[model samples]
Target: MLSRKEIVSILLLLTAMICILNAALFCNIMPIATSYEQLAQQTINAGTAYICILYALSTWVYHSNYSEPRRQIRYVLIAMLILLIAANLAGLVTVVKTLFMSDLSEAMDMRDLFSSFGYLCRTVAAVLFVITLLLLIIILIIVTITACNHSWSISSRQDSKEDLP
Candidate 1:
């Protein structure tokens, strides 16, 4: 079996790659933002990017501590991976839709190619992204506090040992 650190490393790498791909997809969709609706989509994309960073940071903090419940941690990480994948897939679909519509509009000499449905899809993805980020933030806070307590207790024990005759 892989060690805890190794597992964390792998998960972090996967998270990083997913975030990068998601950002790339958002960037690809950015050039067509010429209206308020498109601006809202861009805003959502920015928020999702920030949340992705928070998720990554939280994952690192939670996984670095060995005292946390391994099974629960594994489940949480797996859930996060699934959610991120779902969101990325949603974003990918939106990008494809936007590109296709843009092409069709261009060929037809139309002015706008964006669809409300695509915006809704992007909105759903952003919601998922925010949910995962919130979950990770909670995990990070709990793990950090637990780690501090553990270290404090260990230090007290060592000090007591040093005082023994």
Candidate 2:
């Protein structure tokens, strides 16, 4: 069985990886903004990136805290992630809505690819954001329960030892 510290460390590392991926997606993978449509797309990309990074960092710091009954801490972390995901997604949706109805009169012709790409990118980002948030919650619950059970078992053993000759 993994020690409490080991379990906690693994969770933290996972959280860090999540954050790093988000930051990379935003800073590296996202395209540069030009027109309103591209700008909207880039904004969603950046927002989702920031959201994931914050969620991971927050979960790492929040759960498995110094105190026991880590459930409270886990719940808080989950709530934060939920709010972040919701807010970022809302922004992405707004950007997409605007992009879809953007003033494309300047175009000498109409093409589906240019304006709608942002929608697809943001949509993918939104889905990934949800997945990461859910995974964080699952990880937190698993680790917290394991640590709490370990703590209880150790305490029980100490009680038995103290009562002996």
Candidate 3:
């Protein structure tokens, strides 16, 4: 049976895989872009999807590690994961709509709207990813400082013992 952490890690991995798969499907099924704007939107969506994958995997690694972070930090990470999944789902829906679009002219006319939506979703995901990374860095710094202090105290105690008459 999997532990809670293992379960969470599996879920994260699955979510990441799903995001990447959706992006792959988009790439495979999408018609060649008739305009630069359309190409840019496609590139951004694909890029953001890959970034989401990276974020999910990194978070999973952190969750799997033995060094437990604070409960609040873990909660924050979970919340971010949920938000990222939501954004990816929205992107998936946008991709589907684009794929089944009936008229090339209609797609072109709506290119600006699609591009804006893509930018918004990507920005949200990127911001969350950066925030998560920052939190990880802060945790690492705290852990390093704590370890250094612990080792210093131990060494100081040893020195005092050697000095005892």
Q: Which candidate comes out best when scored by lDDT?
A: 2
Per-candidate TM equals: 0.41, 0.42, 0.40
Model 1: CA > 4 A from native: 1-4, 7-60, 63-68, 102-165
Instruction: Give candidates' CA RMSD values in order.
Output: 10.6, 7.6, 11.1
lDDT of 1 by residue, 1-165 (tens): 974344445445444444444344534343554544344444444544554455556555655445446445544555654554455455545444444445576566332443565455455445544443444345445444545665677689889999999
lDDT of 3 by residue, 64-161 (tens): 43423434445455455455444544444444455344367464664554455554544444443343334334433443455556557768888999
Q: Between which residue pairs do clashes occur in model 1?
A: none
Order the numbered candidates by TM-score, best leading.
2, 1, 3
How well does candidate 2 match the true structure in TM-score terms?
0.42
Write down the RMSD of candidate 2 (Cα, Å). 7.6
Q: Residue 105 lDDT in model 1?
A: 65
Error at 54, model 3, angstroms = 5.3
Better of 2 and 3 by lDDT: 2
Q: Residue by residue across 1-165, what tens digits does model 2's lDDT show? A: 975544545554565555345434532333444345434434544554454455445545655535554545545544654554555455446544443444663563333534456445445555554554555465556655665676688689989999999
